[model samples]
Target: MRKLLLLILLAAGFLSVRAQDVSLTKGWKLAIGDSAQWASPTYNDQHWQAVNVAQSWEQEGHPGYDGFGWYRIHVVIPSSLKQNAFLKDSLRINLGSVDDNDEVYLNGKLIGRFGGKTGDIKTGSFYGPRTYTIAANNPAILWDKENVLAVRIFDTGGDGGIYGTNFSIGMADVMDHVTVNTEADFNYGERNSLSKSIKLITTNHYDYKGKLAFKVTDPETKAVLYEKTNDAAFSVGRPFTYSFEIARLEKKSYTIVYTFTDEKSGKEITHTETTPYLLTPYPSAKPKINGADVFGARPDHPFLYLIPATGQKPLTYKAQGLPDGLKLDAATGIITGAVAQKGSYPVTLTVSNRLGSKTKSFTIIIGDKIGLTPALGWNSWNAWGLSVDDKKVRISAKAMVDRLSAHGWAYINIDDGWEAEQRQADGKIIANSKFPDMKALTDYVHGLGLRMGIYSSPGPRTCGGFLGSWQHEDQDAQTYGDWGIDYLKYDWCSYSEVTPANPDLPALKKPYQVMRSSLDKINRDIMYSLCQYGWGKVWEWGAEVGGNSWRTTGDIQDTWRSLSSIGFNQDKAAPFSQPGHFNDPDMLVVGKVGWGPSLHNTRLTYDEQYTHISLWSLLSSPLLIGCDMGHLDRFTLNLLTNDEVLAIDQDALGKGASQYLKKEDYQIWVKELKDGGKAIGLFNLSDKYQTISLDKNDPALKGYTKFRDVWQQKYVITTGKDFSAKVAPHGVMLIRVEK
Candidate 1:
């Protein structure tokens, strides 16, 4: 019976394994041409040039060169590497991320491939991290000896080469080593839930006779409030979970950490998660108006505005002292009409719920200026990347209307990947199959009282290698105008190809000038946005080129470094901010943003998210939501619906915030408001809770003594000349002060 069972199990093919990786960031020879001999181990590569694989070859000394390239390297494989108690029998190859296409080889044998030639079926293998298994013990590995690894790459256009951080050989799934889902294991948003869960999952064949330790620390004082340890054993992909009630813990955020020690491997892995509590309080159930108090429109153009209000359901809206030809839909709180006259009109907008009623003084300025305040809307880039489609866009539009329209969200902008592969015979650009009907889509959004936006580039191809305006600027602009595109994000992706070698400022301005002229010829107003990544001090010349907003930096990631570096460094461009013109530091990454169809919650901690929204508002930067609107969470919604916080960004004065005080990682930035008040952001850039204070003598808080916590919407009492608070790590104290 035992022998029969053994035979049954053997035939079933069962083996549990885990993998660790060896980073191959160095030692590579690159050449421009591809030959079959290059894949062989015996090929002499001494004459091949050494190159950095982190970026494209164009950025690595070879400029404007795009085509086939060969990368080769050699490394010795340790014989004992496979001997790891839990490691898989076969080695897994990771080529990192490659542009276009790639086929990797080991000892002259093709092991794995990506992109079109591989028949991947999946279109984004080149964009995501790739792992290919050697399928059990393969002779091509040549263990305990030097082995050659070669990569053949095919590039069509734009950026090309083998790039990304991870390039190595591992075993099985890298996550099999350890993956801690902190949010899933804990009651992060449930304040009344006393039970706390902690999970330890590993799929290794070896039973980790490991010790797992859990602890909670006071972030401010570094005091350990709870501590426990358990001798745990786990195998066969089952998660070892530990749960306990933390009713003893306080309401504020505390640092929770878990450490796992594998006795055999002697590996110590620590996972830390912060802010398992909610800070942004829920808005009042009673009626309250929010968002920009001021609105703008072009003379006699189709006018629409949603009275932004937050409260319980069944809210009523009314507008008084309105200009002629405008009507309000009390049922939907949407005002739609076209005013022939161009002037400033003050209207009192009121919203009432069962609990109470709130009124706000609103202004409508119909003149040449548009985008009077930094745009508050959504863009498709972060959530869906190049995979965005018409269906996804429609879903986003409906979501914005249902959940976010009441809080002043507008503009359903499609970024990249919407253009047809080929333009029309008449030189007019058209939407791709993904967006079957661009005109109808615009009408759908406009009918919902929301504006529609489109994207293009000054080059022949966009960043996603789609059709751009290029030399046919007039035709493309005319096409967009005919479709009633309200905004245009003109990227400078492949436009560099047309620029002169070591081009001067004039050459840089030429493409934008061409597009601006083309837009001017159109019959309607389309907000021109410059997406040049803030190179060469664009703020000084952006308005002159007819740009409503210009990018001040490269793309923003969800990491703290990306957020701070891009947001805090906008002071140089602050002086140039004004009505109808603003500095853009990229879109908001506060929600789930994966740059593709697969979305993940932002890596920013809860505190970091507050800092992100606060600093962006202070900078007067365009607030473009780059998340999947269909996946709106309560916490993310609250973070966005804070009327007091958003009012700073929409201030009519349009003066950007300046860094008034900087102390290492602690900073205080202040922006002037249109109402003789100042919006102040006291940011703690450090990793620890810090006592951030403002002195009356410092002048940033001089006569601005009647202070109110804008985020909390409560006035505070302070004595003497100092105002202080123990701000959380990567958090901020947003306040509005007046004399």
Candidate 2:
């Protein structure tokens, strides 16, 4: 009995001991002033103000404060806390994401530092998560006593301090052997399985021999669909990749569980993917017209507008009451010619086939403004990145003409990497060898009734280290104008290389102003786009700098987290948007995206994709598709070609979505339309299906009792004062509310 009791006690002790993390999210003392002596553990912090370290110091009553700040943490480390960790020798602290830069100190010694300004650029890893691991057996650690941690931070502008969620310290464990990408994949091309890439970690010293199992179950039925087990081994510097797939999935979700067991340590790591793949139903074959109701261009400039329509093949097109200079091709739906008149000429556009006929009233607003509404088109960055070439661009243009142009998709904007390695001695930038004939490419796009756009930087080099405008802003502008470029994405990349570090607002606006001046001198109406990642609140001064659109955030990635954060956080910049100017939240992350030569299916689920399109339309953001046009599937095409959704974005009022109601489980954003109606996006932010109910008399509903389901294209009758919907998780129900 004693032997059994001893064994039970040992097992209990072993079970109690684990790679447990100690949270340091709360109870941290902070001060604005910085000093090196504050790093010392013995320093008196009795008078230091107590603060929580979960978010920016701005929210902690330090609003409008910028520059340097310091934070101190005090905690006790028990010797028994490291018991069950196989690699208990090392300690790790996660401070999450800090704006700009930071330096971590423990016991008066610098343990780690991340991101800093170099040269004139105020460079920092503001968005990168911060995780630092202390060396094994480091003397700076107080094993069974008190410890003091000091963090020094610097913010160039805007929000600052220790921000983001992960804040904990834990002993190193042997099971940190793999990282499974949480941004699950969906069907696009021939491949039709929900997949996740599990990469074996090669940073630790221990080798891991384990059994890995993949089990998939019907989320609603709780019945197992597929199961598999495999013996796996991993070691330092060993490359490993594992993927999971389940065939024959329906519209419903599937629960994917991955189980990994270590043979020697007896540790098991399990990951459950509650819902993975989703497929948006394909559109019907009936005729439908898509695109902006209003089109604008400078008088005498080549006017090109494709009657964007979707339906059966061999569709016929016609325009009634077109101006004398305008002409349309009946079979191709292409309108070409220039309007010398400087006035609004209303035209009735019609498209028909054997299946059905559709007609819409479109206005040819020939005047000074071009992008009166946001530009809907495709860019090459997320599709080809620096590998964009003439052949690839031509292929994209052909594909856009074949499938997308009929849906109002336009510009074939070539992103970075088109610049030549050098400029001519006479000072003219040229395209690289990949694009031997730039003007011809532009002409080809224009011939197809599509516009062309190009990218450049205000610094000595672009983001891709290619030639930039620099002192030759006018020269480059003239070159783009001569090349028939209709839009300019002026990236503020290496411009920091020319200016001083932590430049003032004037210096920040200088480069864009210079380019704007150059563009004004040119005869073409080139739409100016400011892409400084929202530094200095660009939305407020964007139009002042002659900008037609300005990026309001950083680059967008194909994941639920990236999409939700960027889309939902647009209220701050929405008010600044209006006609001929818009707030760009980067490009769309749908379709096949890889940011390189190779591409794969996007990591966003079907529901999240619906939310993405609906939100962007309501925000009135410039819709720039960031996927390879040659690889577009039916679902992505549906997401882009929704005429009603596109109308919200192309409204003549040019207003963006404003958060009307927000709660823990859901949110409703409302956008005003030109027709006195309102577009509302009912979004579910929870992890499970939620029923969203709203009163018809709500101010956002504008006393409207009748509504049309925009996506479903059906009217929904509400008998009572309230209307409701059973929204899927990460899903959206977009509707047009009217009397």
Candidate 3:
């Protein structure tokens, strides 16, 4: 009895397998060459080359001539088979590798066609095969007895061949009998090991309703990783989104398998794909060397890069390590403390994400040392807009070095509008009358121990309509190099018009690629500052395109609102900014009085200006002063020449700017320097003088024991928990703290 039951079960499984094999793969003949009347039911091709089904013309060596070709396959249905066939049957033809494009015909009837050699598809491109389906009811398609099928192809370039794949005729006996396709298109977005999180986007085209189920699985282990079932009867065009978190897995190659099935019909289809996943351990949170103080402070604030783990999100730093006066924020990734005695201390940080957890270890070295503070520089835009002339530029350069060089002011940058038609023809770019002797001017600046910086728009025209380096990228770059131009600020103005508003990044990145390539070819050593004003997150690909610095915000005017607005937008972009390539928030608006073609001269009170500088300094922005250094007032000179304040802006570890206090009209910002010190700025925006206090207990201020006014060169020795100082309206106070 047991053997009989086993036999019955075996018989059922065998019958099921045989039933699926009934699919139409037999009784088909193919022919090559194009004929206008090949689609006619009565068409005859007795003399044409004969070929077997499921074969490509290329495989037979008679791939046919290029340009245009045709393929025909004949199928006959017997009267008995037609009567036994299920209703509403469908036949699918899979044409593999048609040079550029092709059209198909079945039983002397036009079935379907797909264009392959047109548009972005070239004759010899990485294109996949195409599949077309046709209804089986038309009499023109023929029901039985020697039916003919034909396909015409057009190839523009490269080898023209047909690499055919699966071909079949399927039937649907009931609504649930429809086949479920398990194909999905995927695109990977931004990813980083520091934030062990990656975005996986997939587009599904099959009906996932009723008994159909969609599932993602691990191919190696055959583990069901993620799965989803459609509750709604969604149509074939509906798109679904699924976000999955793959936990702590070692760096390795993995396959994502997708399966679709109609449980009611027991019909299913599965597709698998493999992608690389690299897992990197997070960098040590605390510095390895201790006893090092930043910004001339006693016990220095910790300085180090925070490496993200695979799939981890941005860290939320919390204070940790050291004595009661020291703390680090795990959420903000900031370490702060004040030390009476300088010594080395070990530091460690714990990082966690959805994937898993890891600890980073290092040490901080504290010491008393002083080095050449980074220089302050002047940029032309703030003082003179389109009105800048050759004499005006020369005069500014001389003034910056003659009066401010002793104060550590070095580079003299000639912002936009310097490329006057004198340098080149076509009015696109050239040194105009502004600087007839461009080389001489650069030489003169260098002679004064100051570097020279020039500006040009990345577009066809500069913002002032002066000469620009658009298509002439290499030529313009060579011109700058030849003229001994030390720095290049490539602005993106009219270029924005060419850039798509909502760019399909994958499609519209060619222009930027070209520009970057051209710039690198011209001069790789020249500082290439990309000024694409944050369009489509250009910074994401800026570094790859040879940009040393890219703008993270829109064009900024000199105003309290504008400064604060641009300052706040820096948080999302803070991670991408590093040494060599920095985030530029436009130029400074310090000395200028908001006059001329310049945007509103930051109507901010002195205090507000201080806040702006503090924020920019902490943010590690390129300190290219836009004010007139030639006529620097006492107050303006002091603001521009503060060595202690400038040290934070040029910290070796590259600390990011953080807001310690935020108010509508007042604010405080700070930057942790390499040493156990801090660059702090307090600003007063209102007309009335306001007294601001620094809270010792504040997490950002945790590592400071004594305060020194950097701009005034005065020290305030106080161990109190808090300290206060009065700031004049529209004025600012820049300071460094020692622990």
Candidate 4:
């Protein structure tokens, strides 16, 4: 009986030891100014502002002050507690959130410091809470009697405070520990109810020296599924990444628990994360065409479409079953093969990624060939600048359709500044006196067998200070659709007010999505062109946003200098253009006489103008003549109506143009056609006529022993390894060769 009583007493003593409490709510003193006297132990802080230990001084009434401030707290260690207890050595002081920067010290010994200025709207900054550790070597930081913990904070601007509420002095074991951040949150790709391999990433930030063990278990059933451990050593401030491939997971929710220990301190940290393991069946690996219509498919040509996978990094795509000689571009998803052997063929495509793979298939029924080249067009911006009006547009449309329709020009576009002052009500669009009848004008253009294009901005004001489509996307789209507008050019200028200078994808996505959805609902077939001047990688998602074309460079002016600058910029965007969508280098500036306070001011010479047209044609840009058709001189008419010059721009083979040779003042451009022929352009950018020579060994001239000068209508044969000729300043020599 006496032994039993002794056992009960021992149990009581153990319970008491476990229930012991430590109070961290004590005296905190603060000092201001340049005096270091507060560091002395004898200095009295009784007269200083008294406050709670874990509180924001700024919230309590410190005003008009944002700079360096000092905070000190005195903590007492109970005599009953042993100096070497693990609990006493594992204490930490968390200072929530500090503006700009901070440093912590225990009894004049620095513990830890984080330095940086507050975040501006442009750059991100220190957010959330910060923590500092108290090691065993500095036990005096919280001594047996009185101890002082000091903190120095610096605030440059904005609200200076320890943001968010909870601040405490607690034992490290009492707080949740994270040895590694949660990595594998959900299964990659499509989720299903089948067992599959799962990959996870583990990051180790703590200074730990031991094996890290990971285990997955069904939280509800308490059944362990997978377990693995790795021998990893991590130093403080250094992060290490570890990947684990675990298999045999079904469609169920599971909890992952990971644990690690410090070899020297014998301290262990454990983390738990929960995620769902889905087992959805994989999608079929066959090509499925989208965006095509119900008309019977043709052997020679048929419109085929497919929506590329969204949210994945862009991919290179290759397709088969196109007419024999044509080749498809895998990187751009463009079908570029020539339909030489006319017969129906089944089309199939396979898309693969690092994670997995997918496939799509369709039928291409070939028939008698129909020409699929883009329609030749004319835009008024090059001819009239901001002076385009109803009378000018109507007369030009009639003249172009009457004179150039037989030569393949089919679109007449009215560029910027078509809106009137009455539309200024509520800053929305309304046609003015110049366009008294919008529908009549559209009909007038259509009556001449031509399509009509108009322009506006995505913001509240256009570049010409006219009404834009900011808050009126749907209204403006409906208005344009009602007026029978065939194409719309949406520019981005005042839109920057709502769009931050450098914004993340999410911030810029909503505005673009709104405009796209509105246009699609208004008229799905309406051609939409986006003009954002190449900002925000708009080309990456321009097609998804309902854009048929997008401006990839700044505005082009009527000069060889401006034209060449824009021409070079087009090279970077070559990879993004496809059959329906294109990269626009602004409008053509061939006939504009200059705008700003100048009359009939011809900026580009006749040779420069020829070079501009030659480059644009070879580049396969939209053929929008900016020259005024009603007032065209004989020279301008001859340049615009040359059938041989138009053939290069209307090439059927859809291949990107290339620059074969480039010097300080000259360049050679060429495009290859599927018919074993080529179009070559030689340009001289200097002020004086210069002798130009072509090397037969160059890739551009390799297949050509003889060529016809299209403009001169004369055939020339090469005599030796090089052909030399004198070209006028800013002159271009356009030639067609049959290999």
- RMSD of each predicted structure: 7.4, 8.4, 25.4, 30.1
What lDDT does the true structure give each of the candidates? 0.78, 0.78, 0.52, 0.57
What ordering of candidates by TM-score runs from best to worst?
Answer: 1, 2, 4, 3
Compose the digit string of candidate 2's lDDT tens values, residues 194-269.
Answer: 4446654445576788888878876446689989888877777774567765556665556677777879988776
Per-prediction tally of clashes: 0, 0, 77, 27
Q: Give one digit per residue, the lDDT tens place, for model 1 in 306-369.
A: 7888899899999998899799999778898888899999999999988988999999998888
Cα displacement (angstroms), candidate 3, residue 214, comes to 79
Q: Local error of candidate 1 at 737, Å?
A: 2.1
Worst lDDT window (10 residues) for model 4? Answer: 1-10
How far residue 132's Cα lies from its native spot in candidate 1, in Å, is 7.9
**lDDT digits (tens) for residues 232-343 of candidate 4:** 6666455445555445554334566777655666556665544433121222333222211111122333232222331133444556655565565565454532354556
Which stretches in model 1 have alpha-carbon errors above 4 Å? 1-178, 182-215, 225-251, 258-270, 354-356
Q: What is the TM-score (0 to 1) of candidate 3?
A: 0.46
Q: What is the C-alpha RMSD, rounded to one decimal, of candidate 2?
A: 8.4
Name the weakest run of 10 consecutive residues (lDDT summed) in model 1: 1-10
TM-score of each: 0.81, 0.78, 0.46, 0.49
